[model samples]
Target: MADELIFYTHPQSRGRIARWALEEVGAAYETQVVEYGTTMKGEDYLGINPMGKVPAIVHKGRVVTECAAICAYLAEAFPEAGLAPTAEERADYYRWLFFAAGPVEQAVTNNFAKFEPSADQGRMFGYGNYDLAVDVLEKAVSAHPYIAGDRFTAADIYVGSAVGWGTMFGTLPKRDAFLDYFSRLSSREAYQRAGAKDDALAAELEAAKAPA
Candidate 1:
């Protein structure tokens, strides 16, 4: 496994996004499940990322963080998976990746965190307002079958997962396009494999914590 990818992650966190991306790339990854009290907050892992976040990756000793960066890196690294776009597709690739990770994520987190921004559009925030961000995403997804237009690339994995999770938790609107796109993404075999593993892991963790 010398050429293997090592992913440090906790299932329920933003790590889910990376998990889906890893599966899409079909990369050989070894998941190190980080327990909350004992491992996730440990000093060693914290040094790898001072933020103490999971979803960090160490592939061939090269470290990468941030969900969108990880997704983009994997797509580029595993070109055989067809997840990466051609040089021609780069603009749309970067655009949607950052859009989902930045605007979409910020809007959902803020809605959950109950954050309110000033009404002024001049404020250059990740998501100026929740509704505005929703409108932006609605128009994009509705415009095409996937975020990067007709291509089903890693950008969809990133953006589709965000849409799926957001709508699942009731933060996002249940628009027809978002619903249909999420349905297609969720039906993918790779997505199912990754999701099943995380579900089992979560169940095991919960069982271990069950009252005696």
Candidate 2:
């Protein structure tokens, strides 16, 4: 069906976020695992996402890229999932969704790349600085059970993924707030289901690359 979602991802990439969102929405989708380097850069996948990034989804012949965007798109596409909030309740939803995708993302990437903006340049950086960015995020998650008010919307998937991956990789500070939020998200059946498949796939890929 044209309405079916076509998900393009790599097991070990941020594609895991999209997989979790897809599971939450109970969407009818098929997965295409793109290999790193040559395969991702090839004409086929590049046509879907010019950036050659994983976690892109094609639905109804339309394409959506970026993890946050995919989560939001899926939430709307599958209203039955109730991942989207009404307009009155959307302020926090949109706020944290973009915050995680923008500032939180900038902070984490800079940390991973070992680049830090000095205090003088903090005003120029979208995330101010890594420490400041993480502190703000910690406060946000600590104040609420979910990213968007009381409901577990798609925003949680994006922000929760950031916290979960950050704590696991030691990229983001493992503050009590982040730890608590991650603990809740990790226990969800959808999260566990998606993680199990990704973990198995990641192991298989790693084993294939190991010296025989």
Candidate 3:
């Protein structure tokens, strides 16, 4: 039956976000782990993603790539999950989701790397600067219960994943805003399950990398 959803990933990669979406939807899927320095560039997988990226899924004969795209697609595909927003809610959904992936992510990465951009907002990068980007997120998250506000939609899946990973990776500022949001997400059973899977696989890879 092809399992309906084929999660092509390297386990420890951004595929964890898509994996979280799958767990939230309670959708059945088959896992295909691609290893780095090896399986990531495999010929068979190249066609799946032109850039040879993980977190791509083949659902209902359509190939979906990019973490946020996969998350949005899966949420809508399986409406039973209630993780998708309606057309009226599209505005907020797209805003936070893409914001988290784009500006927020960039800022987190920049901060983690200690890359200080120009002080002039117009002269700086897409996220302006790390502090400004984090400030935007802090205010937004503190104001809304969820990314889309009120509902825990797939928007949170993307945003939460970013925040979760950012905090864990020591990228974003560890403010109350991030702590509160991460705590809220961590308490969800689906999140716990998805996180456990990512954690276990990460441990497996670490063991594999250790000196024999």
Q: Which candidate is the best by TM-score?
A: 2
lDDT of 2 by residue, 1-212 (tens): 53477989999899999999999998778888899998789999999999998989999899999999999999999999999978866998999899999998988898899898988777888788988889989989987898877768999999999999899889987788999998989899999999998899889888988998
What is the per-residue lDDT of model 1 for residues 1-212, given as tens digits with 9 covering 90 to 100? 72568998887888888998998888788988887766778998887777888889988888999988898899888899999877777788788789888887888888889877777641778577898888888888877777777778888888888899888989898988889989978889989988998999899889988999
Clashes of each: 0, 0, 0
Tell me model 2's lDDT, rounded to 2 decimals.
Answer: 0.90
lDDT of each: 0.84, 0.90, 0.84
Candidate 3: clashing pairs of residues: none
- Which ten-residue region of model 2 has the weakest summed lDDT? 1-10
Q: Return the lDDT, model 1, position 3.
A: 50
TM-score of 3: 0.90
Report the candidate with higher TM-score, 2 versus 3: 2
Cα error, candidate 2, residue 12 (Å): 0.2
